[model samples]
Target: MSCKRLAIIGAGSSGLVTLKHALDRLPGWEIVCFEKGGDTVGCWGNPYPGFISTSTKFTTQFSCYRKWDCEADPASRAKREDFFRGAEYGHYLKDFSGAFGLEKNIRLHATVDRITKVEEGWKLWMGEGTEVFNHVIVCTGLAERPRKVKTHLPVLRSMDELPEGKGIVVVGGGESAADIAHRLAAPELGNRVYLSLKTGIRVSPRYHPIRGVPSDFLRNRLMLSIHRGLRNAIGQKFVEARIRHREKFERAFHANPEGHAKDEAINARRKQWDARLTAAAKDNLFNVFHTKSDEFLDDVAEGRISIIGPPKGDGFREFSEFDGEGIIEIEPDIVCPMIGYTSGLEDLTDGELRVRDFHLGCLHVRHADMFLVGFARPIIGNVPTISEMQAKLVISLIAGNLERPRDLKARHEQERERVEREFPLLNTEALLPVEMFPYCDQLASMLDILPTVRKVGLRRWWKIMRAPASTLHYLDDDYDADAVDSQRVHSPPLITGLLVLIKLIDLVYRRMRRRASSRGSVCPG
Candidate 1:
């Protein structure tokens, strides 16, 4: 087969996976990867202090690689320095690229300026000139732009303007806040730091549900039963909840219809959510605080941090000496904002790639010729699962083993109609919402259109079927004896019986409805 040319942007986790998948599927294809941050900072290339993946290493690793020697024990999670400091992950990526002869294809210190649609395909402008490619994949990681403290906290005015030796209050309750607090509390800094959390953040356990059947079993069962009718029902429920929430908000505000009451109402709602979130965070297994910002201010009154106004609906009110409270203030040296980030794809593309806003920044590419590999964000499923599905889909599309359904257009039209009928508000100009699990399942099913198993051992199958937990061990290509021994029996027959009973009830209900219709008279049982 003739080689095809492909260009990929950003050398982050997603970009590396895309390179690996493409090489496996299209061995003859000429691929080039571009990284703007030079060769020093992609994946494990650069190690920033206090850097660790939020995701476990098992879920984070590529499908082809297994981190654990045996499935009996969970794979150990790697700290930031372990994976990043010595360029361990970078070495892995380099080795992966070399294995597939991809090292020659990577171009470091290259930046993609814009992409323009051309007659045959697309043209990517990089550095001083342009490169034409049959296909282009954007693997820019999830964070589009960092959410800075200055942007979120208007009261700070400027980070540099803050005074020295005074405690700086940082608001936010996420992992970032924890890191910042740790930094401030360091002996070298010798500065008092206050963390203002409206509600506490929940820190996930190293592991979840030590001894219960995996949630995936239940979720899969529910998903399998979601036929067209169930989909309409689910969609309608979502619409109703949205409408009800809006109505409740309007009622609570009780402002003039012509007046601008939205801001106040939104603030009030935000405060309520903040309170609930804070409570949840406190009650979490970890040491999350449930105290209000005002309580923290009380501590400030005792020479902790300056007392800002009592935590009001719209965060702590901005206080000045002009106000009644005579609070002594000290300037804080550094203000670390733990605000989140958005996917930074706006400047990466010149609007040539269609992004579906609802899918958490997924590109809208219907053709098998163009595949989006790893765009799902904040999803529970492992990254490799989605990547593998994408790889298979693209492979099938390229090999001509799978063809777009003849009724694809009609199906899409029907889906639109269904959405409109069930979710009128969602029918607005915004894109259709696609959750991670459903998207993964859909992609997997599509790729499975042509069933072909590479190879599998009986021991591996038994281990996978009996595994009571969701782990990457199941997805690994290598099979180990310990993995098989650690497996547990499937859920008892009682649960299966209950499911069968529910199906039978539904069957009987449908039959009764048919009989009632056959008899013109209202069938009085």
Candidate 2:
């Protein structure tokens, strides 16, 4: 096949992974990666001090490269300095690019202004009106724009603008709120920080696996089996309930009971609902909460941090005084608004992209050549997995590997039918991180693209098994050889055997339970 010209924008984790995958799939293709930042990771522009990677190193790394040797423990979170300072991530990216012979293909210090569609493919416009590329992949990342906190509060302009060494309050209950609270409460800051969450959050119990399998592997397998049974009995509603239950279970551990109290009898009904949810979570292995934001609010109220009511009026005003109503009157030096980020695809693509109102930001694949990657946020999985899946799908489409009808109307109808049959809740939104891993795995399987595992010899595997996590090296030749072989072949025999054993155990457990129930002695629910 003739070499195709591909241009990748933003040299972050996603872009680097895409570059590596593209090189592997289309070795003859002319690939040019344009990164706005001088460094590869692009963390230089928006550097966050004391930032840590939320994802485990195993899941975070590209399929070919494993970070297991360097802090391989999935339970331990990687601090900014541990991986290499934020700046050093860029260097690792550079090294990754070089290792794959992609350094020469990358155009650093170059920003893509706009991408316009052409007759053949697309044209990317960079600085000084330089037009380039036949194909373009925008890997600019989710954190490109900051999400605005919609509150009428005059004192709180932005979270980042909050003063240090004074009482401060943060709104929102997601990871962003947790991160902001952690940052504000840091020992160095010496400031009282309060997080105003509408509802309490579910924190996962951190655990490290003794073997190759993650702790979630066994738990998720059981959950997935139960989910399948529920789906057969109650359909989509049951699946949704299970998903919600799983989330609540995770939240229960961090829940504060005091927050559930209400002043009025009608409010007590709301509290009942909260109690029901908490009880439901109790049945599961995970922990959850029935707490309100006011619990955290009270801590700030009592000299910890100032938590208060909603600001007067709706939306924003020109300016206002720092009156001590609900908010602390102290003048904040910096307000670190830890609001989340969204995909800013409105400016990039036209209405033709067709984003369903149900699933916002996800593009309907109109043309085989154009594809959207990292659109949906998965709650159960990792982001890299999603990106990898998207990349594989795109590659398949470009290679004409996907089964498609020639007739336009027939194809459209066929596509709709497929979506309805396969993904009935095609419009359903996904929670971040968790959904990420499964969605990526699903996408890759759909495209028949296996993960590119680096092959290692027996000696190398032995060495890696014996070596400590801190001393492990990913780029070692011994590891690479075996990983490469693993990528080419199907699932390893050992993995298949383990899977069979797990299934046998599950079957035996189910039969035993069935036999106990059939005895009519009233088996414990």
Candidate 3:
């Protein structure tokens, strides 16, 4: 097969940038991008309707042009906490596509149906025609399809259809659920809204408590190092418990003894939820993915909206069987399931790729030409950077520059085990959120943007040893096209040694765990 043409599906953030970089790295190579939406921005195509972006714009925004560097609005420039409206974000993505000159290569409104192996590399069916390319990259972000849980009331999936003078129950703990709850708690809704959480979830404010700075600013290399240090020093469980307790500890800020009678009333309202709804929140306080909330919790405490549902535990049961009084009260004017979307794995393949862990959930070993990007759903942090890093890894692999594990099967088995162990609560359909710091660092190391520890300067190399996490620091406009050419280019000794040491440690750890479990040692259950 001649490696002359490349086909990228989905013109989302990942696909768009992949197209741009491929052009830059592989000049004159024929690359065509298929986007089902008429416009390049996938989620942003109907951006105004998705409510607001939960992630802060500054860090979430990916750019090669540095376009957002100079904001004309004084208020926005001075304060980075304010989020952009959906329309604004859509425009920004469109601008990014234009800045990178990707419009020409993007075939708008093109939907890929299935891909099959071909003598030339792979064959694809897109609508009325068929095409084949040397490589195929799926960049569709995780919005596969909305999971529907049949409720007594008609599930209201759209925000515009929300009616006043009716009770609504929204089931979820992610951005969509929080956004809907906050909006429904408006005076017009008559305070008859409820949110049902199924797992421990964090409801975080847009800005930090003391500094009033955006949370994205704090998500840096230092924060990653701190996270690793805590995980190491006290263990992951302790660190997680501390995080889960953070919200409960913040009660001191709200409970004021010297306040007016109205303050006492608000506090009392908060207490009302103490027995009924706080069960999930208390357990999941720091356990689940954090949902960005500006007013969901405040409204809940003030009796504007009520909370319902038990978290994942012995108390927890399926939603269909749940007969919580809160659900019975509203009877639910409309049930909204804000649970996240799934990756459309079925559409990507007709054979062989059905059920297997694609390299870190991106690369495929059975059919090496297959690549799945923008599928990882991190519980926190923005996704564009993940998309970028994943794309970088994909291109590097395709070019034959990166090395596979000497014992590829062993590595894959270990990775699979780790994923399943780390997230026991997540179902098979749900994409478990990755630990961003190390995942991104591993991708960066693979790209050689930062070399293995032994090859770099002492200080720079030490940082990698600790954790290679930084957002804006690693964006690259160009890359070496010949990176995938060397078959013998194994990873540096540092990377190799680190992997081996980690395996040994994990082996011992798992053995201890098995022993503990056999002895009926306590688990989260």
Best by TM-score: 3
Backbone-clash count (model 3): 7
Mind giving the per-residue lDDT tens digits that candidate 2 earns over 140-191?
A: 6555233455553433433344355765555544455545565566556678
Candidate 1, residue 446: the lDDT equals 64
Query: Model 3, 184-268: lDDT tens per residue?
Result: 7878657488777655454454553212334443344433433332334333343344234434423432211111125756655
- Cα TM-score of candidate 3: 0.75
Model 2 ranges off by over 4 Å: 1-3, 43-46, 69-91, 128-132, 144-163, 207-340, 350-364, 401-434, 449-525
In terms of lDDT, which candidate is strongest? 3
How close is every model to the real structure, measured as TM-score? 0.58, 0.60, 0.75
Residues 236-349, candidate 1: write the lDDT tens digits. 343234323533533443311221224655445443443333334432311221111122222222333331321233333332331234433534444455544434445555
lDDT scores of the candidates, listed in order = 0.45, 0.45, 0.60
The clash count for each model shown is 7, 51, 7
Which one wins by TM-score: 1 or 3?
3
Enumerate residue pairs that collide in model 3. Answer: 200-284, 244-286, 399-484, 400-484, 400-485, 401-483, 401-484
